[model samples]
Target: MGLDFSVVPEYAHFLWIGVVWTTVLTVSAALLAFFGGILFAMIVLYAPRLLAWPTRFFVWLFMGTPLLLQLYLIYFGLSQVGIDVPALVAGIVGLGLHFAVYNADVIRAGIVAVDPGQNEGARSLGLSRAQSFRYVIIPQAVRSVTPPLGNNLIALLKDSALVSVLGVAELVHASQLAISETYRPFEFYITAAALYYLLNLLLEAGLRAVERKVEATR
Candidate 1:
């Protein structure tokens, strides 16, 4: 259907607020997930079998489960066990952890993609293990993984909407509230979808720019 100018004009400010919330949630969640994922990736890459196996299990568990179910478990299921995390915290942690699991694999692949000879060169230079990793291996791995990592980040941005179920007042939540009051399902949902699309488009463009910059430095 055509754009509902009447509803759009009336709710523009409200929708802008929702977009801001969505951006905040997405960026915060992405940062959390990236750090967590990198930590997990390091463990899997360098830790002993004993440590790596459990880490692997965690990655599998989070990656295997549906994100929506994970959110519910954190927000609702935990409350059943008398562990009450606030809705916002649960939402951020759930999505961040979930993305971290998948991003771990991508990171692992990036590390693996780095030339084995580079590690050898670092070792031959009398660099310690940590030095070698910090200066050589990780740098290349990051370059190799930038595209995939950015894709995961963008996915995380869109997935933030799943947290709306917990009433986080994000974009989807704002749209739902508007729909409830205005009784305009089509307008609200279509607007929400368009906003999400715009978000992804902008993120993709940013990632492309980053990729180019990284490539130039290489």
Candidate 2:
């Protein structure tokens, strides 16, 4: 059958709302994942064996599981256990935890890539281990990891579509709703894909600008 895009203009506003929620979910989850990743990286790198083992296990658990299952557990399973969670909240947490595991590895690799001599120099300056890591190691590590983190941000943005299953009203969810009403899946889904592409393009541009700035400052 020939494609019909006539339904697009009428539902543009609905799609726009979806875009907003998608952006919100991506940003919220990305921030949470980034910080959580840093924490996990620190735990694995510096925490005692007692702490590190459990932290490693936590990372393994999330990394080992499918994000869909994680989302289901958080949103649906929790309710089953008498702890109800709002769809958006559950989505954010699920995305955050899933990405955090990967981010932790990126962060840890960044930290490991730094020269050991840098840490020694910081210590020679009478900086404690924590102080040295905070002031010297983390700054350099962050620089090294920025590109990977930017890529993860893009991935997170794409993954936010998965939250549709939880009915968070994000882009794909909105598209599905429109399809149900109009029975024009092609138009709605194509529009949704275009919106996602545009968003990723904008995000890539922004990340490139930031990367250039980081490079210029170095």
Candidate 3:
């Protein structure tokens, strides 16, 4: 069938709403995953054996599985156990948990990359372990991990498409609906892809600005 551009103007508003939801999901999931990753990294690095083992297992379980399966388990499988979660909530949680595992590794590597001497110097100043980590270690680690975190943010934005399966009405889901209604899959999907590309470009620019600002402080 010949491609039709006419549907573009008619369905632009519908797709715009999808873009907003996609942005919301991506931001919310990124923030949730980032903080969770920090906590997981801390637990793996400093917690006692009992706590560390479980935390490591949590990371392994999520990291080893496909994210699409994770989303299904949360959104659909949970309903089987009489625990009903909203589609959007499930999508956010699933994405957050899945990416948090990777984020934990990035954060942990950043923490490890910081020189041991720095922590020793902090301790020599009579700082407690917690204080040394807070004042000396975390600052350095955050700077080291900023780029990886930015990359993860972009990945999260793209992965947000998976949530469309749950009927979350994000970009991909909206595109699917539009195509089904108008039989113009190419037009809608291409538009969705372009929007995603535009978002990633903006995200990359913002990340570069943040990276420069962080470097200035160093």
Q: TM-score per candidate, in order?
A: 0.92, 0.95, 0.95
Q: Where is the poorest 10-residue window by lDDT in model 3?
A: 1-10
163-199 in candidate 3: lDDT tens per residue? 9999999999989988888988899998999999999
Q: Which ten residues in a row have the lowest lDDT in candidate 1?
A: 1-10
Q: What lDDT, from 0 to 1, does candidate 3 have?
A: 0.93
Pairs with backbone N, CA or C atoms under 3 Å apart (clashes), candidate 3: none
- Please write out the lDDT profile of model 1 over residues 105-184, one tens digit for every residue: 88888888888999999999999989898899888887888988998998899899998999888988988888888888
Over the full model, what C-alpha lDDT does candidate 1 score relative to the true structure?
0.88
Task: Show where candidate 1 strays beyond 4 Å.
Answer: 1-3, 124-126
lDDT of 2 by residue, 1-218 (tens): 78989879999888999999999999999999999998999999989999999999999999889999999999999999899999999999999989998999999999999999999999999999999999999889989889999999999999999999999999999999889999999999999999999999999999999999889878
Rank order by TM-score, top first?
2, 3, 1
lDDT of each: 0.88, 0.95, 0.93
Task: Estimate candidate 2's alpha-carbon lDDT, on a 0 to 1 scale.
Answer: 0.95
TM-score of 2: 0.95
Candidate 3 stretches greater than 4 Å from native:
124-127
